[model samples]
Target chain A: MAAVGTPLNRTLVRVRKPFSEDRTTAVVATTLSVLALTYPLIDRALNLGALDDLFPIVVYILLALGLNIVVGFAGLLDLGYAAFFAIGAYTVAILTSPSSPVASWLPFELNFWAALILAFFTAAIFGVILGAPTLRLRGDYLAIVTLGFGEIVPIVFRNAVGLTKGDQGLNAIAQPNIFGYELNSSTLWGWWYLLMLVGLLIIFMARRLRDSRLGRAWMAMREDEIAAASMGIDLVKTKLFAFALGASFSGLAGVLFASRYSFANPSQFEFSTSVLLLSMVILGGLGNIWGVIVGGLLLGVFDRILSARATGWIQGLGDATGIELLEKVNLRDSRVGFFGLTLVLMMLLRPEGLLPNAQRKRELEAQATPEGEVRVDETLYDKRGEPL
Target chain B: MQDLIQALLTGLALGSVFALIALGYTLVYGIIELINFAHGDLFMLTSFAALTVLEAFAIGRGSPLGTKVGALFLALLVAMLFGAVVNVLIERLAYRRLRNAPRLTPLISAIGMSFILIQIGQYWKGSRPLDVPRVINRLDLLGPLDIGVRFFLRDLILILVTIPILLGLLYVVNRTRIGKAMRATAQDRDASALMGIDINRTIAFAFLLGGALAGAAGVMYGQYTLTTDYQRGFETGLKAFTAAVLGGIGNLNGAVLGGLLIGIIQAMSERFLQNGSAWANAVIFAILITILVFRPSGLLGEQTPDKA
Candidate 1:
């Protein structure tokens, strides 16, 4: 930052690399998208049960991709991301569900289509509200404040039985409509397809932003806020945008989640869920979008499908080996421990994260000396009560 | 006046407990600038450790006063030692290598450590809240004549256990060589190393002392609340952390002040206001956010330009 020439360029451009450099990457991405799109159709034809499982994981990947913008690109550690997710879902529920007071109070309740648009903006507004007060604090302080915000939102929702219906939660969310046609809810492929398209578009937009001046400003702030500020980067605007955009993505996923489940409950979005999303981004590799997608997919599948199957496998092993310990221990029950371990091991072994961005990798691995020391003059305020 | 006085005393009792844990957070943060996220969980484990030791000794209210106090003393000592060792182990295993790498690395690892300790607590004790063994009797110490409120022996005992530890922490920090090394390192690690201070050892000792404080707090917490759960650390530790920040993180006396103030506020809110029980955390957090936004330095914290 002190030196003005060639500010280290790290683009979130993994998907768009020339075919010559990464033929496999492009091909695999194409094949995956095509497969993801067509899988539900195949599920319909074969009557497969596994396709139903993809819904949650796909939505989570979308969430992780959104979070990646904040933690990965902007270097803001948002411990309370589930707050935005909650905001999104609750917005949709209140707007669309007939039982909701808002719906009845209005001349007519908005449809699912209208609520989705409202959810995005409402989540973004909440994102700003949460982000505004916290911009000046450093990493851990920012994190803790976000954590508090995260805790407060759900608690408020839970307590406000008058508004949120308390623990009963809002139910009977209408099946989503698409261009005047009612989509089939029993067969979830249509929703899955919609979510997949949204995820792809966000990822694409994120990639473009990575190369844009605003993304560079974010990188500047993330790399060193003081230096970035010295270089005239608007720290407030950049951080807020990161929070706003990151939150909007989570809101998108929340709407999808509420619609599909036909219910919006506070319990569904909790600290553990936030931790799960964060682990996905951190383990996948911070700052690398493709890596985040990979991280989300691996962990999602593990958490959803493999973890349950692993429990059975552990039981089978115990039965075969006659080891009482394996039978006594349940991996699913201990999955939180697994997540905790993953975070610690990942940070220790590779602080750069799994599949780190090229620039983020260089910076993390570079043993970059601590940014120019904070001095008395640079302190936010002074003893005489004058601002520094 | 009666309600106010009652709230005041209750807040102070709770504050003393918070002060102990907040001291640990301040100590670690002052030296390493790493918020030991696991400190709260470490305190949780120490309570379980104390319980297991007490169980092994079969000491209870039924025993003679000396044996009862002695067994409880022994358990406290064991918990202190266990907490100190485990804290150092966390530092040595997870943090020592990342000393110079990056700030975020150790922090992420610390979070990971918190989760691990929480799970261990869950597995050791069941997930449900366990009723803490009443080692200390619950007779009201402050009167036959009700002053419109009761200050139980439990509150007095809480003060008895906590105050001495606070005094000891002050003595160690103000008077001892390890304490001096810690101060020097906190001021400037590289400079302290140049001046022949064993920086690593100093940092390790900081964790040890921090762990000891956390362990001591854990026992008091269990005794005061009469229940322990795995998630106890998440709530208590977070409150303590808020205290540390409120007191001006890295400022020793500030932590004590912050803890007392927070304890009082929580007590007052819980007792005096409608729906205060549910709103206490939200209110406290609102204060935290307000402080960070309006006055990041906190009530007693000085602007330390030299430190990161």
Candidate 2:
């Protein structure tokens, strides 16, 4: 009874390194957490009216982290990631919104906290349903299927007027409450702190997953699918887990988004949203958690703050110079163009991204020269992961 | 039955235009495995070019038949040239360097290019839809023949333009030396390079050919729909890409067949299904997912050896 075989031992493996082991990661994480915690105070002191506008962007960063798992870790290209976001938002909207069809059909409205939990599972189920059939296909084909699914989901939401309210969408979703205080749009500090916590939690979880056994399997599969499978990895299971897990994160984001906005609309989730999230992931550096956070923040600031300000500056120049052409110029609606340019230029000039993952940077640099030549010696070593 | 036949005729006309665009996708994909996401936006830009030409000539419905015909022909050639030049430039500047990069690299670049082109389109035409003056006669060709179903002159024109382009494309790919080089390069880029084929030139030729087709399709689409908008590219491109995928992505004949089938389905759905206009796109997307999952090879596509 005291020692049956091997005395009951709880500790099997050490998952995390001591803080001193990785000074850079530790310092960066601490600095970011401190800054995030103080951001509302900073915004208030500076009189920057950006606090409200910047709220949803935290959710976007969460989304990019989720996408990183599938695209970066598993090496699956998902062009329809926004569909999962939409599904999650709709789940929360339907369960908690007073105007939802559920209000008429069911006797009780689900609690916001409970609905948030439900949204994650609902979106994950949808992810499994979509991923099961297409996971076995080639990478590009999987992209097309996901793109189709993205297009179809919004259409379903728009057409099912009874369930989704068609184009009008669901309104008056319940906001999160604790004790005597409620978290809504007006409580900017409340939401700012809440989202910051959620973001930190997700980052912690994503990092842990990245360093776990499954993470290694994902990297192996990404490098060589056949070799990974031959090494006894279950390809479909590994892929499906990444897909569903990624989807659940988006679902969580969707709930936060709907609750904060107090509404869910079909127009909010579109192909452009998917592309925007992708650019953030790529811009930050795929597969790197910190890189994605920085990338998402830069883009969010640019999208929410700088883009509009740039238009104003352009008009101001035009007014100062009395130049009609300059006056008429507007970059306010040119977000798509800017994102597009970012994608192309980044791919062409710095495909490894702004904060390149060490291994990916090595793989990319080793693959090509300025003249697009595959140096014979480099190719041999890069392919089989050998240092000659 | 009459409605069905009429729908079929309209579908065929629409299908012909889709086929032209799908051919461009198929040809480019056949040679280079990129999806050319900007191809649809290029089509949009070409239609704007055609509109500029028509407006420059001041050609309208009231113009004499001879003037109308001359202006349209000029527009077609100009649009084709414009499309070909831009497409080649895109290949040289945006895509060539990424040829040997990861497969996703080029695809993402193409998506970026699509967005850029779309922005250009918005700047050129503004956000509102523009009306294309009816330069062709609206008389029904099948009326005098008493076929019991109406077939408009526009439908005839689409068919007439399409058949020649299809045949000419077939001849070029099957019989021409440049075509031979294209096929060779597609089979093996390094092997073709060893054989002294100028790989870049051959690829440029494919883009030129594809762009020309897109230009022609643009002109026909403008006249058929009588309206063009910057956003038209996204919708039309999605449908044409679906057609390309449905037919077996790299096969020329398969693209045409797929285009026609998609057109028929769209038209029939619009005519028969409740709220069909709104639901039509959803149906196509559903079909696309189903096909990719169940049969990635498509109707006529051979099992691509690259899947492994």
Which candidate gets the maximum lDDT versus the true structure?
2
Which portions of model 1 show Cα errors greater than 4 Å? A1-28, A41-48, A368-388, B58-63, B306-308
Which pairs clash in model 1? none
lDDT of 1 by residue, A151-233 (tens): 88888888787788978999877667777657656756677778877888998898888788889898878788889999999
Alpha-carbon shift of residue A249 in model 1 (angstroms) = 1.0
Write down the worst ten-residue block by lDDT for model 1 chain A: A3-12
CA lDDT, every model vs. true structure: 0.83, 0.86
Q: Per-prediction TM-score, please?
A: 0.92, 0.93
| Model 2 alpha-carbon drift over 4 Å, by segment | A1-28, A366-388, B144-148
What are the RMSDs of all candidates, in order?
Answer: 7.3, 5.8
What is the per-residue lDDT of model 2 for residues A198-250, given as tens digits with 9 covering 90 to 100? 88888889888888889888877887789999999999999999999999999
Each candidate's interface RMSD, rounded to one decimal? 2.2, 2.0
Report how far off residue B80 is in candidate 1 (Å).
Answer: 1.0
Instruction: Give the DockQ of candidate 1.
Output: 0.48
